[model samples]
Target chain A: MAARSLGVVGARVVVVAAAAALWELVTRLAAQPYFPAPSTIVPRMYELWFSGPVTHVFLTDDALDTFPPSLGRLLVGWVAASLAGIVLGLAIGRSRVLSDFLDPVIDFGRAVPPPMLVPIFFALFRIGTPTQIATIVFGVIWPVLINAVDGAATVDRQHLETAKVFGLSRPQVIGRIIVPSAMPKIVAGLRLSLSLALIMMVISELVGSTSGIGYRLMTAQQNFLITDVWGCIVLLGVLGYLLNSSFLLVENRILGWHSRARQNA
Target chain B: MLEIIDVTHTYGAYQALGGVKLTLAEGELVCVVGPSGCGKSTLLRCVAGLVQPTGGRILLDGVPVSQTPDNLAVVFQDYSRSLFPWMSAAANVALPLRRKGMDRASRRTAAMEALEQVGLAGAAGKYPWEMSGGMQQRVSIARALAYRPSLLLMDEPFGSVDAQTREDLEDLVLRVCAHHGMTIMLVTHDIDESVYLGDRVVVLSRSPGTVAGDLQVSLPSPRDQIATREHETFVRLRAEVGRLIRGNQLSPQET
Candidate 1:
């Protein structure tokens, strides 16, 4: 098992290294301003991010000012959407009347693209922190909500029967049995919603935003700082990958049984 | 005492049970045997008050059952599903105790005692999914026993396990019921199991199940698997129950 997993990690590293080498080769041959080679972009990204003057921490005031707000907004938006989606989804999923009545409205809301909704949020909340946060929350809510509904709706019949046979009350049944059974699905929804949250965070920052990584990227693009633009792109890619991997870390902890079953199968 | 009076359950136009009547004296163990597609489960559901009969009523200790009564518990087939997979064996057993408004310590003690009775005392901390089919069904039985219900309904509880485990569970049921003086109505499709475990065997007809025959079991208790099977009384009753289930009445002399 250990050898097999090591082989997998080794294979992944080889693939990533080969892709970077190919990109470096292509960019060097073309020698274009629009496409900085990987070698230039990698060191430039490090200098732009970690090159900040050492505060007590490694981060400079610039890094501190730019990175935290984007990360913080994603966290807050993802958490808020998760909480609301689970509660509302359970209620809607359990009741036929509620599910049917809200299905159309939810469908319409989700049909609107995340970036498109940013302007509406800016108009409603008047273009500030509230607007940016609202846009992220709105974008991420659908995945969590939809998955939660599906999860709660498909709870095993045997579980419900066991609950009834045990004489669990209505609230006890919902709180104990229904919620736990739906939890694996809920966590899956949260993972999808986190990525959507990142997308909305960037779009929200694109307009009427001045203090995030997204703002810095937009500024770099406007000023024709091609190297800085490439640097920001690399940083964002790293950030997105880190966010997803960290979420997986937590997801694996919580859904260990679920994944273990899948692996065994 | 439990009374299932002329219970008839229908789903749309298809009848699952038609006018089934049965009764159990307090502390009696009655095994219900029926054909493969018969309404043994439907009848058990009616007795447990999990399902309502379209026509007729069920009574447990003189109270008409519209919903599951607080003092009653059921062990269903598909033990893998009935026992909550997420909960430990002890916690699963303690589940019914939560409904009775018992304190946590008392619930835990009682649940442990139930597990002890089913010979699964060491497995208290294990989850249902971690156990084999036999052990899981034992956990399901432990859950019901922990409830301390006066009346217990078991629906094909041992059907999923292997031959050896089935015999062990059969003996466990007899001991548990006799010791606690708990009234039990066990439903199964196994004729030999019905004879071995029951003080009375109630045979059910094919579909739209109604009582075909109810015979008394006179074999002595403190029963051993080998000795019990070899006993003249056990052999006679098993054959008689077998014939009844196969749609033949007992010979006049046997009846």
Candidate 2:
């Protein structure tokens, strides 16, 4: 198993390397100002983010200005969206009356594009992290809410019956049975929302003043720092990959039983 | 004790149970048997307070069962679905005990004891998916036992396992029933199982199900899987229950 995984990793590395080489050749030959070569972009990315002293873990001051604020907004917005979506989803999923009352509104809310709401949010919050966070939350909350509703609504009938028979209180039933039963879908929703959150973060930053990677990308574009813009895009891709990988690691640990149970079934 | 007084239930236009009446004495093990779609499960659910009958009512220990009684637990047929997949065997058993107002230590102790009683002490740390069908059913039973319910309801609890495992679970139920003196109402379609595990067998008619017959089981105490099944009394009782179920099928009833 270890050898097979190592081989897979080796294959992935080779594929990425080959793709980078091809991109370098094409872009260098084209000599396009808009598309910088990977060699220059890679060096520029290092200069922007990773060339700091050892005291700051090799992060330059630019890195501090770029990553933390954007990441912090993303984290805060995602966490808020998660908590609200799950709580509301469970309520809507479990209660027929509530779902009946709120479903049309939820559908309408999720229908409007979130980036379009950024301007409205800017009007409300006046150009700060609050506006960006609202944009991310509104953009990303639908997947979590919808998936959680699907999960909680379709909880096994026998499980609920068993809970009822055992005389579990309402809170006890929700905590012990409903939440765990809904977790697999909730985690799936969270994963999709994470990527959406990243997209929203960038979109929110692009239209407003900010100290974030998205703002950096916007500034580089306006100044025609083509290499720096490429570097920022590459950094975003890397950041997204790292976030998804870490999320999957945590998901595997928590949902290990769900997959095994499905196999048994 | 449980009393079902003319319990009638309907799902839309379809009547599932039509004025079914039965009663269980404390510490008695009664098996409800009938043909497929006879609404034995519906009757059980009504008693468990999962569904409200369209007409009539069910009473447990002289109180009307508006919701699940405090001292009651149910073992469902599909153990895989009934048991929480994320929880370990011990945790599943202990989950209901939180309402019992026991401290964490006592809950753990109770869960462990119940697991040990079901011959699953070593598997306490294992999740439901980690165990075999029979073992998972055992965990389900352990969960009910840990709740220490005054009344226990089981709906086709052993229907999913192989014959050998089924026999083992039947005997396990017998042992636990005797040991705890638990008042149990078990629903199954299997005549032999009804005769083997029940102190009395209650038969329901086909769809739009109603009580057709109730017969006493007179098999010897400490029932053995092989020896008791081979007993002449067991044979006669099972045949009688089978005849009742068959007779119900012959009668005209709306699908």
Candidate 3:
């Protein structure tokens, strides 16, 4: 297992290194002001991220505090969306009446393009930070909610009967049997939601925010600071990868018994 | 004591059970044997309160069974379904106790104890998919035993297992019931199994099912599979059950 995982990690490292080398080679060959090589961008990213006056300039003003405000808004909006979606999904999934009543509404909402809602949110909430967060929340919630409902609704009938024979009350049955059985699908839904949430966060910031990586990317484009724009893109990629990996780790811990059996087979 | 007094069940317009009556005394292991689609399952479900009797009443100690009673548990034939896939064997056994207000550690201990009773103690940490078909059924049995139900309802619990595993499980069940003083109602299609495990075997007719015969097994207890199969009384009882199930009427003494 250790060797297999190490090989996987090595393959990822090689792919990332090859991509970076290709980008550097292409930029060096073009030698354009718009396209900067990794050698030029890497030092700049390191300085901006860790050791330079970019932090002072960016951190001093609340409107210029890109990293913290963007991260904070992302966490808050994502958490709210997840909690609401899971609760609503479970309620709808467990009841035929609720599922029938809400199915059309959910289908319609999910059908609407997430990014297209930005203008409506901007117009409604008037382009503030809260509006940006709301846009992310609105865009990311449906996948989680839909998947949660599917997961909860598809609980094995025999397990339900087993719970009944054991004399479990309705609530006890839901908590002890339904939730655990539905977890794998729920985790899959959360993974999709996490990626969508990140994308929505960047889009909302790009459209209106005074601070955030998205705003920084836009400003760097206007100033022709190509390396800084590339730096922000790299940061977003790393952030997204970290979020997904952490979620996978938690999922593995909770579902170790299932995965372990699969491995043995 | 358990009683199914003239119980009848209908699904839409089709009648499943028509006035089925049966009685089981304390510590009695009664097996209900019948042809396929004979509503033997319907009778067990009515007694378990998984389904309601449309006409007559089922009573446990004189109280009518409208819902799953507290001191009863069922072991279903599809072991893969009866045991939760997401849980460990011990956890599945402990599940019925979640509503009984016991602490988690105590539930685990009780579950392990039951698994030990079923000779599956080493498989306590294994998930349902990790175990073989027979072991999975044993896990289901362990779950029921952990609940310590007064009346145990088994609906073709060995139907999915191999013949060898079936014989072993049948003997194990007999031993456990005898030791626990458990009153059991087992429904099966196997004629010999009905004679082997049951103290009394009740045979049911085809759908709109009704009782055809109820014969007492006078075989000695603590039965060994090999020796019991060779016994004259066992041979006679099996033949009698086979004939009754085939709708062939024999004399009372022959049955």
Interface RMSD per candidate (angstroms): 2.1, 1.2, 2.2
lDDT tens readout by residue for model 2, A1-265: 8999999999999999999999999999999888889999998889888999999999999998889999999999999999999999988999899989999999999999998898899899989899999999999999999988888999999888888888789998899889998999999999999998998889889988568988999999999898888898999899999999999999999899988778877
On lDDT, who's better, 2 or 3?
Answer: 2
Q: For residue B111, give model 1's deviation from the true position in Å.
A: 2.1
**Candidate 2, B2-79: lDDT as tens digits:** 899999999999899999999999999999999988899999888888988899978899999998889889999999
Give each model a TM-score.
Answer: 0.95, 0.96, 0.92
Ten contiguous residues with the weakest lDDT in model 2 chain B: B246-255
Q: Please provide, for model 1 over B14-128, each residue's C-alpha lDDT reduced to its tens digit, 9 standing for 90 to 100.
A: 8889899999999999999998767899999888777888999898889999987888888888987787666789988987788789999999999999999999999999877
A200: Cα error in model 3, Å: 0.7
lDDT of 1 by residue, A109-200 (tens): 89988788777777788866888889888899998999899889998888898888789988888887888788898988998998888878
Residue pairs clashing, model 3: none
Regions of candidate 3 where Cα sits further than 4 Å from its true position: A30-33, A52-64, A123-126, A261-265, B248-255
lDDT per prediction? Answer: 0.86, 0.92, 0.87
Q: Write the per-residue lDDT of candidate 3 for residues A1-265, one digit (tens) a residue.
A: 8999999999999999999999989999999987888898877777676453565753334334678878887888888898899889988999899999999999999888877888888888877688888888888899889988998999988788778878988887888778887777777788898888888888888877788878888898889888899888888998999999998899899887667757654
Q: For all candidates, what are the clash counts?
A: 0, 0, 0
**Which regions of candidate 2 deviate over 4 angstroms?**
B251-255
lDDT of 1: 0.86
RMSD after CA superposition, every candidate: 3.3, 1.8, 4.1
